[model samples]
Target chain A: MKSLKALNNPLSTGQKQLDLLHKGTSETYKPPLFVDTIEPTGHFPMKAKGVEVLQINMGKMCNQVCKHCHVDAGPDRQEIMTRATLELCLNVLKNESITTVDLTGGAPEMNPEFRWFVTEASALGKHIIVRCNLTILLANKKYNDLPQFFKQHKVEVVSSLPHFSARRTDAQRGEGVFEKSIKALQMLNAVGYGSGDLLLNLVYNPSGAFLPPAQASLERDFKKKLKDQYGIEFGQLFAITNMPISRYLDYLVASGQYEDYMTQLVDAYNPMAVEHVMCRTTLSVGWDGQLYDCDFNQMLEINCSGTKNKHIADFDLEALENRNILLDQHCYGCTAGAGSSCGGEVV
Target chain B: MSKSYYEPSDLGKFGDIKDFQPELAEKFFGYYNSVFQEGALSEREKSLIALAVAHAVQCPYCIDAYTSTSLEKGSDEEEMMEAIHVAAAIKGGAALVHGVQMMNKAKDMSM
Candidate 1:
């Protein structure tokens, strides 16, 4: 019940400290459920059918250190793919019929070879996607020209805009991030990215502990709200189910919110969403050139079987195609409600 | 960095702090209530989100409340188990990421 200012002052780091102090104050009190220690009943299902979507984790390096980022991406992270790995990925792109070459990262633009990959992929008529953390466009001078670069390539840019409001967005990201994001969005808009036909997709994960509202409904609401409130225009609003991980998990723990959120995801499990899970069609490749069933599994380091090519150099389309997918609790996020993926609702 | 922003002494100010600004407290409480209400979201949906959020924010009270709530809302044991796994993946990935910071620090320190 402390003032909202008091709650906001310390930031997430402060919240974590408060949790520790609170725990120590109540010596006789029994600890709450050990949500992290709870073992999952089923293992990750690893039956990968085919790699239609080629996702490349350009690196772990990013501009913003947001609260719910599953990748734990930040400027401090240096786990970037080397030029050698880039060549390997590009080599696979050459022989493979990958319709979509998804380039992701701390910020895909952070990678020195990002343009190289995008240019090559586009030349091959491959649909290229950059999982942009919009603020990155404004993070540095070198990146300021990204809007123009993206326009030239016609890359389908999927940017994360956690909320329309500055406060909510900044609460998840860092202070002033919402302002930068707005500026970046406006920049993209100027380039006709989020305008009528430029194909700029904005992603919106719930700011609080909840599954996103229905995709169609939420998108409609977002389009209207963003346009009316901020004069923002975008093609689609992708409501991604925040896969509980990393800093977000730490936030849940620090704020004593872990168990409730998990229960929420579990209770909202929708079986109809399973068939359209993005992993069914797309294959996620990590920074080190390793392969994963999907992006979530890649984040978890769950690799495909030994028979298949583990890295991009070993991009055996026949081998990776029809492999078993590895599913854990996070997979439910992709299968919950209308389902969620980098490209918006799966089903 | 300090692990928490609030001290045990701060809890004493909880109700009293809100007492001064009754309207703001009411607003937050109202927003919180509406968030949990079964409007577009079902009771089951609320519980599931509370559970996922419990993991995301790492709140014990929220976690405890939603766990039971999810079960009561007819969530099966397996579904609950999977949600935890999602939490684990995210948590684990985040922690492993610190290795990059460590590596950076080590390189800088060495220099």
Candidate 2:
């Protein structure tokens, strides 16, 4: 885990990660049996668990254009959730029983209303999670104070590191990202973020077309490496599978790894992971306020199904719970092995 | 469609040996799978060892398989290259050690 550098796709900056299967579309899903379809006992204690975690993609603008970016996010992209849409999301959290407000994006901080949404959601007594891309904190002097702001709101910060080595991390994310990320992480630690209840977590998705190793052990490696090398400390590690979408999918096809990667996903598909996939509990809201089963679907423009409540304005916890979750090839990125979600390791 | 004696895709079908001999292949594969599980030497370590052995045996298929395995298991490039070097050192040492026999034969034959 010294250099695990997870892709954590829009791959949760709404995902914090996903992978692609290039060739076969053999096992068509019967609306992929999401746990919401079944009676959720609300017993699962995993983070981002339960019928909550209102994940909103704040924008598609980012400081870095990662190689496996599922969002295809970059500086040129101007799309972002407006304050109006964020108000609708806040309204849903206000009335409905949603417990977590997960903010992600090309870089959620880049959104004009990002801090406003977090403050409003925090005021609502809902737990907040920010899928930070560590280097963004150092992207500009204006954003430099992000760690303190995050601490003030008690936001759970989940940033993708991809790998611990500078060369490899730079290869995937951008030049000098690893150094800046380290500085950002140290700043977060200085603010007492990764200690006590002020949570700070790291995301590790495979840089290439491969599944992540075990999470718990990987977390241990990350802890040792960061602590040893940089005296940095964090809470946990989320090992997300890289979803084949956007830039990642494009990489797969160009490199001719798509077919083999897809075969790996198909072979490693764990039915046990299907029931607890993030879409079952977590509702994905795009920048424009459209709803989908998960972030992957949001990227593919597969809106909320089996119900008409497909936008933040038409928010309906009951209807959404009863709706059939959409499924496709990219979903295998979530179900393979222990399962990948915003929280990481679903099973 | 295969045009070579060693098709890389065949590695994906290592299980296909079962199609020809179900009983024996099943037994061998059962043991093979068990052999690679988390044992005294972690799976990552085993993968590196497999890589070294693959080089020693010069098995293209195993080299390809274990290289990918080692990478996914969190072995960095340096670590993997070091493993290969270990195999190379042994192979080189084995040949040099045989030079002692040559020395003995030369001494016995003349002078």
Candidate 3:
């Protein structure tokens, strides 16, 4: 499928003014404004506790266009990060006390400077995480050796496998994705992933409008099915709630499910989940070297609030740590039910 | 008077039953919530059973609630459909098994 950007879809470039759905009458059930909803719970003007994870978007050039992608990333995108930006990121890591550097992208591997950044970041003694879409490892012969490369760098390999069933997974991601994902997972296991401390994790988001299942039970099911059927082993299954933004927001609006889906998100809000939101510890660097509160904020052009020009070159940790996390209706996605983050359910 | 007996929105008002009879509703909900927790049977197992029971009674609200609950508890399409089949078989069997009584009564009426 072509990306929203490639198709010239309204939701693609127009997301800067995306609606947060804070509307309704006093007599009716309007989901309360996300910021207001948190006030009673003592999270008014949510602030970042610290920055421990540096999530860098290598670029928006991915091989496949999954339906729920927030990045609107696909092969048509030309926004690869330049070597200068990556060098600046490395310099920041060298100076800051930040511990982990997470590499993500259309597919981070698709970035020309991807390997160079990984090698450089690994050299800094920084824990590295690569948000690999498993199919990329099998997309081309040149990309086939990524598993071995990741294993060497001690990079935590996190890939999305929406469902263990091919029909369900492919329905959401794309045709033949489940087959290729299984093949790639087996490849990772062959290199000792999911064994000892190699740390291979799979991510699951619901195929449709519903929230993801309980993380522990779903992980058990994923482990048993992958092991018993395809002889694949994965360490953890991160159940991330799909945020209503970009391609996913487009899906909700087009399917006539916008109100129902938003209602579900609002009604299921959990205050405990807010306390562990990924944004508190993570800073997202966009492909163009700009900084965002989180990846979702980056997608929506919601930059860090404390500074005027919050770019990676600036690298103001103290300012960013104190900045109020910019909130929107989309944030309900992160705090819904068990809560969602890069590492899965926060609560 | 919205004409339809089952309003999808009514499911959200399931808690409003407390406004009518708070003590009884509270006790029932306490029991209902605890019944679904992981115990002798895993929560997944209980969800499948609940899904089957929802189908057996043919309650629209229950069918909707349990269908989503079953999925949330990690029950897949195949397992969920299988649970429905269990409900179907028992319901069908309840009618067919009564044939033996009819057969005996017919014999009693034999000339």
Best-first order by lDDT = 3, 2, 1
Superposed by TM-score, candidate 1 places the C-alpha of residue A124 at a distance from the truth, in angstroms, of 1.3
- Name the lDDT value of residue A213 in candidate 3: 72
Q: State the lDDT of candidate 1 residue by residue for A75-132, as single tens digits.
A: 7677899889988877777755578888887888988888887888888888788888
Could you arrange the candidates by TM-score from highest to lowest?
Answer: 3, 2, 1
Docking class of 2: acceptable
What is the Cα root-mean-square deviation between model 2 and the actual structure? 6.2
Order the candidate numbers by DockQ, best to worst: 3, 2, 1
Q: Give the Cα RMSD of candidate 3.
A: 2.4
lDDT accuracy of residue A286 in candidate 1: 92
> What DockQ results for candidate 1?
0.02
List TM-score per model, in order: 0.67, 0.85, 0.93
- Between candidates 1 and 2, the TM-score winner: 2
- lDDT comparing candidate 2 with the true structure: 0.80
TM-score of chain A of each: 0.85, 0.86, 0.96
